[model samples]
Each structure stands twice: as C-alpha cells, then as structure tokens.
Target: MKYRKFGKLDWQASALGFGAMRLQIIDGNHGNVDEIAVIKMMRYAIDHGVNYIDSAHGYHRGNSEIVIGKALQDGYRSKVKVATKLPCHVVNSTADFDRCLEEQMERLQTKQIDFYLLHHLNRLVWPKMVKLGIFKWADKAIADGRIAHFGFSFHDHYDLFKEIVDSYDNWTVAQIQYNFMDEEFQAGTRGLQYAYEKDLAVVIMEPLRGGRLTVPPENVAKIWEEAKIQRTPQEWGLRWVWNHPEVSVVLSGMSKMEQVVENVAFAAHSQPHNLTAEDLALIARVRDTYRAMGPIDCTGCRYCMPCPNGVEIPRIFGWYNEAVIHNSPQRLRSYYSDPNMLDKSERVENCIKCEICVEKCPQNLPIPELLDKAHAFLTAKG
Candidate 1:
C-alpha cells in the first residue's frame, strides 16, 4: 500500500483510508448490516495495509461504529487508527458533546478515538460550536485520553473553511468532500491547499463524488477510452485527488470486496504530483465533457442563492443535472427524499416561480423552467 505523510502527526498513513459510511446492507435495510461481508472486506483492507478507518456517529444510522467495534476485535484494533465524528447538527447543549463522544466510544469499543472530527461543519454551525465551548471540550477530551487528535470535517464555503482553520491552532486534521468534480465546490482546491499550508492533514471524503464519477455517461467514458493510458473511472477520480501533495489520505467507502481490492491496487501506485501533463489534460477533457452533457451551465457559484422563497435553486439544479447527465435517478431520488439530506424549504416544491432567480443567474439558465424540469426529473419514479 502507498502511504503519505499525514501532516505533522508524524504517522505514515496509507494513501487510501477506509470510509465506513456506505456499508452494504441486507434487503436495502440500513439497520440490517451484512456483518460477515463487512468484516471480511474490512479485515482484508487492514491486512493489505489500510491503517485508517473513518466512521461517524450517524453513518449507517450509528451501526457503522458498532460494526467497527466488532471488526476491530481479535487484536485487529491495534493495526489501524479509528476516526469518527461528533454529530454537531444534533448538538443542543454543551453536554451533548461529551454525551455523544462517550456514546461513540462505547459504540467503537475504544477508549481513545485516534482522530475525532466535528461533523458537517458549516458557516452556520462554527460559531454555535465555539459558543458551546467546543474547543474546551476537545481540550478536555485530549487531556482525558478519550480523543488523540482534534479535527473537523468541513462542508462550507472556502472562506468559512479558512476561517475555521484559522480559528483553532490545535486542529491536527480536517476532512472535506473533495473529488474530480468538486474542485470548486465546498472547501475546494483552494481550501485543500490552505489547510496543508497551515500544516493540517487534509483527509478527503467523496473522492468519487459519492460514487457519481465511477459511472459516467458514454460521452465522458469515450474520452477515457480514447486516452493513451487506460484506467477505471474510479481510478481516474481517486488519482485526481491523490495527485495533489496537499492531500493526506483519501477516504473511500468501500462496499464490496472487489472495490477494496481495486482501490488498494490503485493506492499502491498513487504518488503526489505524479500525474503527467497528458494525464491532467485527459482528466480536464473528461470533466469538460461531463459538464457539457449537463443541461444547465450552472457552475454552482451560488450567485443565485438565498432564493427569496427559501428555494435552494442551485442545489436543486445540481441534483437535477446529476440525474440527467450521470443517469443516477435512484440515488438522487433517495438523496432528495431524505429530509435529513435536505430541508423541505430547499426542495423544488418550495420554488414559487418568482422569476427573481432567473434575473440574477449569470448562466441565465431560465431558472424557473429548469427548476420545474429538476422537480419533474427527480420526482419521477423509476
């Protein structure tokens, strides 16, 4: 397995960290975990040199942590560093912090969480976390031996990411939803480099864009097929993120044994800044091709945000484009249906067709018409 310097932590972490968010389940039931399969695949990864296991309090509805506790048994716990998150969205008080940490510890069956991150941090939650004395709680956790290192998994604007990075000098690591498609999204490339410059280890999540990049449209795949060097779509996504030295380790939620094997093989060959000029050109072409396939030219610049009626116009369009361009209707449907994923206010059902967003949009994408199409496309049953 290939390894990278994980910031100032002085540890040689595998280039590919195991993400436990998408464990395979039985009959589509989130609670009915396929434990035997999960255990075998995870142990296979560990045996093959994946030393970092990332989980969260809410992943797989908290069963992920429970399974990790089971999978890391039989002396396997000593082989890897377990990372989990504090579900900051559920924090109603300062007591919730310790309560959740203790609960996660019990779930993981570990005394000290190697890496504990503040989950789903954004511009809205940072101040509340600070106001609730999160830094003090972290210091206490570290001093008490419950948390080995402090960090946050970000999902906010790049400026907010920099603000959070600058807020705490004790932050040892940070996780972001980064991939080939998200270079300019939340905490994009700029944020990745900023964190690295500050000496914080950048752990990448969604290196495959939640598996979106793995299955591209034929238009995009043809670009790869025409390239001199052949690689899996997954490899293209993984390598794009790993190519940057600013990144520390990438977290892929491997759900199958084959994926684990393939990813491990890719990690073996991934090196910082090693993708040649041709390789970069190929990726850029593929990205542009995929973008061209989308109906709207919305760059996700969020310029048309704050929809007067509280409609998340850009996000709605984003999901809409995914369903049409990538042919991922089922995933988008599930994603949109989950209230936890997006509020009802953000839904297209909330769009009042005020024509205000259309006027503000730089793409001039006929915002109302597109929202109608987005609503129709995403809501259609398969």
Candidate 2:
C-alpha cells in the first residue's frame, strides 16, 4: 500500500481507497450485502495498507456503511480514514443536514467523520444546498469536531464543477469521475486539474469507469497486447490515473479478494508521469477505438442546449453512448435515474417529438428519435 499527500491536510492517504459501493453481497439486490465476506475483504485490504475507505449514505442502500462499521471493530477503526457523504437530494430543510449526519454516524458506529462530503453535486442541487445553509451547518460541524474535513462528489460538467470549487474555499478534498477514456466528460481531466490548482486533494472515482475499462473491447485488448510492455487491462487503467501527480487516491469498488490483491500491488508500484510516450499513444488509440462503437456521435458541442422541455439532450446522449459502449447496464441505469437529472418532468420521456432541437443540432442528429432509443434502453431493465 503506497501513501500519497492528501491535499493540505497533514496526512498521507493510501494511494488506493476502498470504495464500499460494490462490496460482496449475498444477493444481487443493493442492500443484501454478505456481511462475513465484506468484513474479511475490508480488513484484509486494510491489513495490507489501504488506509482509506469511502462509502455513501445511498451506497448499497446504506448497508455499505453498516458493514464498514462492523469491519472497523477490534481496533481496525484507528487504522484508516473513513470517508462518507451526505444525501443531498433529500435535503428539504436546513435541519436535514444534521439529521442525516447523525444517522450516518450511528450507522457507522462512529462519533466523528474523518472526511465528509456533499453526496452528489449538480446544477439542480447546488443552489438548493446554498439556500439551505449547508456552509453554516458545515462550519458548525467542523468547529465542533463532529466532522474533520469538508468536500463534495461531483457529477456535473466542468464549468459547473469549477463554479462549485470556487464557491467554497474551505473544501479540504473532493472526488470526481476520472479514467483513461473520460478525459472530456463530466469533471474529467480539466476538472481534476482545476481542483488541484486550488490545493484540494482530488480523489478519483470510477478509475475503471464502473468496471468497464477492466475488460477492454476486442480491438482495445488487441492494442494492449501489442503495446510491447505487457500489462493487464486493470493495471493499465489504474496506472493511467496514478500517472498523474494531481490524483491523491484512486477508488475501486472491490467485490472479490483477488481484486484487492491485484490493485494493491499496482498502487505500490504506481508513479506520476511514468508512462512513456508510446504508452500514452497506445492508450489514446484504445480510447478512440472504443468510443467509435457508440451509436450516437454527439460531439457535446452544446448547440442543442436548453431542450425545449429541458430534456438535456447532450447529457442524455452521453449517458446513452456510455451504456452502449461499456455494456454497464446497472451503472448507466443508476446514472440515468439520478434525481438531480432524471425523475423530473424534463427527462427523455418528455421529449414530445419537438424538432426544435433538430434544427439547432450541429451534429444533425435526430433528437427525438435518439431520445426514444435512449429511454427504451435505459429504462428497460429498471
């Protein structure tokens, strides 16, 4: 387990963080965690050197934190920095902040949170959080020693991400979705650098893009095979994230014992900017080849912005492309159903066949038809 500097905090966090979102489970259901297996996996990872464990109020329907609470017993609690998040979507009042935190602490069997975050930030919830006095409550929590650090996990575009980071100077750390293939997507490479420039510890989520990158497409696998320097798909994915000195810890939702073993070894040998030029070119080629498999070729130019009914055409297409390209049914379904974006009156179901966006689209995509396909595929399993 390799440790790295975690922003301005006077601590060195392990380079690899254990994300409890996908812990071992008895059933396929979100909450049916296999407690015994989860305990062993977490303790074994910590015993090796993973000093950071990240969980969320909604991960595994709250079983994630509970299992971690159980694993941290017997003197394991002091060996790691426990990170979790506030469920921002349910915040209807200022008091909900304290209520949720208390619930989370109780679930975790802890008195204080080492690293606490605003669960998922986006355009819709950011202003709502501000109006609800999140900062005032967070200030009280920090001053009272109930929580040690403040931060957020983001799912919005780079512009909104910059705004949120600049809005709070007290943020000690943040988490973002970064991978070898998602350099231009939400909170991608640009957002990572912006947070780093602000002196914030940037933790990486979905370093494998929800496990999609771990098994590259046939073309991508062939490219990897010919890279001359032999490596597995998982190693390539992780090393790319660690290659950047800006990244503090790369989080992986390890469900099996073997994953923990392999990822730990990779992190131990990871170094920033260590990939050779040939290696970088190979990675770029692989990313491009995989992206070409998408059905919609939307360039994300935002020309079709402000969907007449607020459908968010570009974002919808992006998610659709992601679902098709990665075959991540569960991951994309969860993202499509985000309360911040979906479940509103403005989702794909509300496209209404209005060709207003068709006229504005620079890519000449059939906006209404594409939305229909996206809706059918994403909502099919759910």
Candidate 3:
C-alpha cells in the first residue's frame, strides 16, 4: 500500500480508499447488504493497507453505514479512518444537523467521525447551509469531539467548487467525481488543481465513472489493444486518475473480492505523472471511441440548467448513453430505481420541448429529442 499526506494532518492515508457504496448484496437487493461478504471485503482491504473507508448516510438507503459498522468489529475499527457525510438535502433546521449526525454516529457505532462532509453541495444547498448556521454546528461538533475534520463532497460547477473551497479556512478535504471520461465534468481538473493549491486534500469518487469505464464498448476495447502495456480495463481507468499528482486518494466501490485484489495491486505501484505521451494518446483514443457512439455532446456544463420543466438533461443523457454503449438494459432500469435519482418532476419524461435549454447549450444538442430518445430507451428496457 502506498500512503499520501492527508491534508495537514499528522497521519498518512492509503492511496486506495474503500468506498462502501457498492458492497456486495444478496439477491441484487441494494438494501439487503450481505453482511458476511462486506465484512470479508473490508477486512481484506484493511489487512492489505486500505486505511480510509468512506460511507454516507444515504448510501444504499443507509444500510451501507450499518454494514460498515458491522464490518469494523473485532478490532478492525482501529485500523482505519472512517469518513461519512451529512445529508444536507434533508437539513431543515440547525437542530436537524445534530439529529442527522447523531443518527450517523449510531449507525456507524462510532463516537468521532474521522471525516464528515456536507454531502452533495451545489449552488442551491450551499446558501441554505449558511442560512441554517451549518458552520456553527460543524464547529460545535469539532469542539465536542464528534467530528475530526469538516469538508464537503462537491457536484457543482468549477466556480461553485472554488467558492465552496474558499468559504472556509479549515476545509481539510473535498471529494469529487473524477475518471478518465469525466476530466471536464463536475469539479474537473481545474477544480482539483484549485483545491490542491489551497492545500486541501482531494479525495476522488467515481474514479471509474460509476463502473462504466471498467466495462467499455468494443470500440474502446480496440484502443486498449493498441496500448503497448497489457492492463485490465479497471487498471486503465484507475491509473488515469492516479496519474494526477493533485489526487490524494482514489476511492473504488468494490463489490467483489477480485476487484479489491486488482485495485490494491494497481495502487501499490501507481505514481503521479507516470503516464507517458503514448499512454495519454491511448486514453484519448478511448474517449474518441465513446464520443463517436454518443448522440448528445453535452459536456454537463449546466448552463442550460434550471429547466422550466425540471429535467436533469445531462444526467438523463448520460444514463442513456451508458445503456446504449454497454447494451445493459438491466443496469439502465436499475438507474431509474435508484433512490437518489431526482424526483419525477425533474425526470426526463417531464420535458415540455420548451427549446429554451437548446439556446444555452454549448453543444447545441437537440435537448428535447435526446430526452425523448432516453425516455424511449429506459421505457423499453423496463
């Protein structure tokens, strides 16, 4: 296991952190986490030098935390720094903050959460946090030994990410979704460099783009074959992220033991800026392959956002592309069933063909047409 400096703290975190969101489950039930399998995976990871474990109050509808708590038993708790999140979307009042934190502690069976974040921050929720005196509660929690460090996991634009980073002087870390295919997506390379310049440790989530990059289409496979070095698709995805010096830790929500083993092996030797010019060209080839198959060129700019009909245009197109590229109807169906998906009002079916978003879209993608295509694909799969 390779270790990296964790912000200004005295401890060093493993480059590979175990994300608890995709713990193995029984009968494909998200809520029914296989406790034995989770324990085995966690124990194996810890034994192999994964000292950082990330969880959340909303992962797997809160069952993720419970299973993580169960896995940390038998002295496994002392070997890792447990990171969890406060569900800011559910916060109605200052009291709600304490209530949520207490519930997380109970679920994790821990007194002090090593790393606690304001979950899923965007323009709308960041202001609400300030209005509700969330900073005060965080300070109080730190003072009372309930939270060791305070930060946020971001999903907003680069400018908003910078604003959130500059909002507090004590933000120890920030988490973002980063992978080979999403270099320009939410809190992209610019955001990562900005946070690093401010001395904030950047923890990466979705380093495999929620497992999409690990299972690429045939066109992408051809690019992989052109590479001089032989590596698994998973290794190719993680190595791309690990090549960046600004990334402090790469989190993989490994569901199988084989994934854990492969990831640990990759982390053991992956160094910053290690990719050669040829390697970068190979990644570009893979990206181009996907672009060829994609219908909408949406870059997730969110400039065309705040859809009058409340449609999450970029996300809908993203799922739609994944379904078509991977030919996985079951996976597409599961995405709609995700509890974290936006409400029906904001779903793809709600699009009213206003054409307002098309004017703002940089890609000039036919927004309504893509929404119709995504709706048809999802409905057919269902």
Q: What is the C-alpha lDDT of each candidate?
A: 0.88, 0.88, 0.86
Best by TM-score: 2
Clashes of 1: 0
Question: In candidate 3, how many clashes are counted?
Answer: 0
TM-score of each: 0.90, 0.93, 0.88
Expressed as tens digits, the lDDT of each residue in 1-382 for candidate 1 is: 9888998888988999999998989899987779899999899999999999999999989999999999999999999999999998789786898899999999999999999999988755777899999998899899999999999998766878999999988999999989877898889999999999999999999999888888877788788998788898999899999999989899999988899999999999889987889999999998888878787788988888778988777667777776777777898887677665567767887878888887788878798888888788888898
User: RMSD, each candidate, Å?
Assistant: 2.4, 2.1, 2.9
lDDT of each residue in 246-353, candidate 3, tens digit only? 888899999999999889989987778878999999898888788668666766778788798888787777777766666666776676555445556767768889
Residue-pair clashes, model 2: 0
- How accurate locally is residue 61 in candidate 2, as Cα lDDT from 0 to 100? 92
In model 3, where do residues sit more than 4 Å from their true spots? 301-316, 328-381
CA displacement after TM-score superposition, residue 52 of candidate 3 (Å): 0.2
lDDT of 2 at 246: 95
